[model samples]
Target: MWKMKPSIALSVHFTVLLLTLSSRGSSPAGKETFSWVTLPATANLTWTPCFDTFQCTKLALPLQYSDPEAGEAQIALIMSPSNYSSNDPNYLGSVLFNPGGPGGSGVSFVQELGPYFRAVIGPQYDLIGFDPRGIGQSTPVLSLFKSPPEALEFYSTYPQNVNESISSFGRFYAQANILGKLAVDRYPTIAESVSTAAVATDMLNIAKALGQDKVNYWGVSYGSILGATFAAMFPDNVGRFIIDGVFNSHQWYQGDWSSSLLDTDDALTAVYDACVEAGPSLCALHDKSSDLIRARVNKLIDSLHVAPLAVYDDSDPSNISFGVADYTVIVLQIFQMLYTPFASGQVIFEALAALEQGNASAIWQGSVTMANDVDLATCNFNASQPFVVGFLDISAPIACGDIIADEDRVRTSDEAKSDYQRMADASSTFATTWYPLSEGRCAQWPIKAKDAFNGSFTQNTSTPILLITNTHDPVTPMVGALNMSSGFTGSIVLQQNSTGHTSLSGFSTCTAEAIHAYFANGTLPAVGTLCQTDTRIFENPSNSSGYTGVTITPLKRSAEDYSLGEAARALAGSNFLAKSAGFFGRRW
Candidate 1:
């Protein structure tokens, strides 16, 4: 409903855009000075260029903003400039970005996707990414287990065996115990400061250090939550921000573990339905019908729950072994693969076909191969079982700090177990494994963040944010975006009638273009806007390009059947969600 002033119009040219701060005078004139801090904008800061194409910088922020003068910590950042320099009329300032995993290295994100971002969003604004406190490259680098072997041991000890039945609670409980003890030992006081609020403040500080008056952000998945927090805290400092693959802050911090995961199950179901449509000639496990293919996959899951299948293990001199714990891990892998159906559809079909033909070793071997993003040796699955210690070491604390805990309500292990059963009954496909995994890690997380905000989320920012989400995202659902929109008054939503973890890429050329337009010129798509998904799950390039509204079988119950409080309780009973191999089919 609101538009940028004519003075700040895209075509308007200015000889100079001065952005400065002083402890004495009011904010400087122009659209570039932030007067929020009482001191000169440039405080303790340093920047250096590294890797030939990027600038690396560190800001010494107070360890605890509440006690700023008490202690300080270093926050690391990496910057990739636009094609146009500040001296050029084409320069559009900086758009700070966060790539989802609350613990995901922002430095790595910029270094890895700098060129792609510049191409998609336009090479006018500099792309800046900063590692939040307690995360990668930042000081107090939340290292859970120092070495690769130690990290392996932490995962190996939990849920001890790969062949253990899914019904067995011993493995999950064991996992919770180790996670809880390890988090306390590793992070201690520092973990308390890792909440989303703290990270939001870090973003503001980074913007000020970079000499930007307002904040410009692009965050995906969990990063969406961080973006929202920033907009809320620095409403007047709002720039153009996009929260893609929107995550529901309420569901994330509170509970309703089942609700958040419901869409993932649907996404998985979509993959099966697509495979069936492709037919056995094209799909390896495509039997006679789609229903039959789904039934077959469910049967495999059941069988694994009954007994772990034998698989090759290079760690064993005999070269053969089976651990029950690996079954859930492998299933999780399958879930991740399902995210990019068009890209990895055939590979998934082949993997399922191998399983149908009784080749269990090949499946685990496949997982090892796909998850090799690193040196391959880094996440060596040659051991007795496989596991990955991902961004969770930092993600857990930040997430735990944000949500209101249900621990006191549960009171005992038996109550927690009962609650888990209730969740499984509601939707076993999404809940059974994921609910337990996420809860296990969080329940054991020791500290409650003193700075985390769980109060009213309303805010009147200078400019409203643009929220986007795929119709069927695997991790953060469409419902999340819908719900999150209500909290931010005046915010607009763009529903990409597609399916995936995020709304960009080949999935929807339309969605990508819409995002590009907003960044290039601050124009929001009209209310109730829905962009058609140009690429179908298994559709080839020559096929018709448009949204197919092909409804994957909906969840049995209406979402309204459960309340947020109920969902929160469900989440409270669980701990850490299982970690994924960084990328699909690539384990580094």
Candidate 2:
């Protein structure tokens, strides 16, 4: 995973396309003052206790921004003041929240994490959670494939042979295009409606609707991109803003999803290296870290390519042979498991070991289920199929049509494929085994490289912003976060030395203390400050006992909480046939 630094220019290009959209009119400057326009309260509105002891309400905004007269989309919004006193006009403004996932649901995340936030921010700020446009409980929720089976069908049947790959790619694109059109037909203008730019405008509108002139914001993952876009468009109105798991604005639009994959591989290798240093007692591969673990895993994947392994029970109609793609899926799955030393050393090792024994069920069946559950709980979309379909439906038209231009489209599929292939080839030591296995869907999806993807944020405004990142995050990657930090003029970066998707929720006490201090008193941590948290703390499953002050429950024994276990089983079962299925199917 550790490699020499590569130029971020290409990555930046893709990010810009993902975030920056060229508006018919220039973005509203942060310094610009706008008056609030109040609308009559609607009967459909409902209220609940805020996550932190105050009243919260769900508000509806026009589904079509261009036509305010059009019907509305419901957004779950929670508000809790810094102080509980009845009279506080001088109240600190509300801070809108986003937990990421162009698809991640904010309401649920707030419910789970609100207490922690309340403890940190104290009684000085009102925290708000609202589902983004076209997401959870928000009107016109985008549901793609009906079941995980449908998605698994597509991913499992993806073609690997040159001719088959080409035809499969074509079919996948055509199907996705059709699906997007259907979603648009069902909810007209929805594609153009869900852009981050539109969402930014919506945030401002929400602030005005709540009788506030300005607002503070906290966004994670995709949420960060949303927040940054808002800051770019309305810098003057920007209050205290925090963006965690920062996404590079440039790489987003350029259609380089590969970077995220590479980041995962790099992160995994980092863990593997650490395991080697920690010695055999801590890492299964032990003295064989470099050769036995890494090499053996690669060898198993290669073996699967030659002779697919049968992983399902003969009685099961859904049983199939495992191939290369399954291998990639399992590898990706293992990438996340590395978040803990025990998971990395034990669970992942067992899974990999199973694959070496020619068993594919361990990898294929579990991954498919995890992917599906992620979609259901977070985005309320189907992940069984290529995720591109859901993303394209909600993203492409806005990202591609508005921000990126037709001229900027990558001239040919061959060109784009070649670029990706080159990156894969350069990383042949690992990429050869994993990259091809992972890129089946993106390769098949219809994407035209856009020029708008090449731009960068010129945050000329003086508004104070805070950026947080995990030093070893696999998903968003540290480099991308650093790129965003450098783009902002007065922004500060807080680095948490830990592993995981985002740094805010799970981090070192030092980092939490710094963030809490900032939220309470508007103090920014010094740039390049490092907060250390040992990720291994969670490795001892019993640690949950201390936190919850309850007995640790075995996953298998708790049927009520078996939702996670079942989902993992489903994913593993479905993906059992792909080339890399063994990687995910094996048990610890």
- Model 1 lDDT at residue 13: 8
Residue by residue across 99-118, what tens digits does model 2's lDDT show? 66454445544433454455
Q: Evaluate model 1: give its TM-score.
A: 0.77
What TM-score does candidate 2 reach? Answer: 0.69
Candidate 2: C-alpha lDDT: 0.49
Alpha-carbon TM-score of each model against the true structure:
0.77, 0.69
Best by TM-score: 1
Q: How much lDDT does each candidate structure score?
A: 0.58, 0.49
lDDT of 1 by residue, 103-172 (tens): 6556655654455566567778988877678755566656555555666555444442222454456566
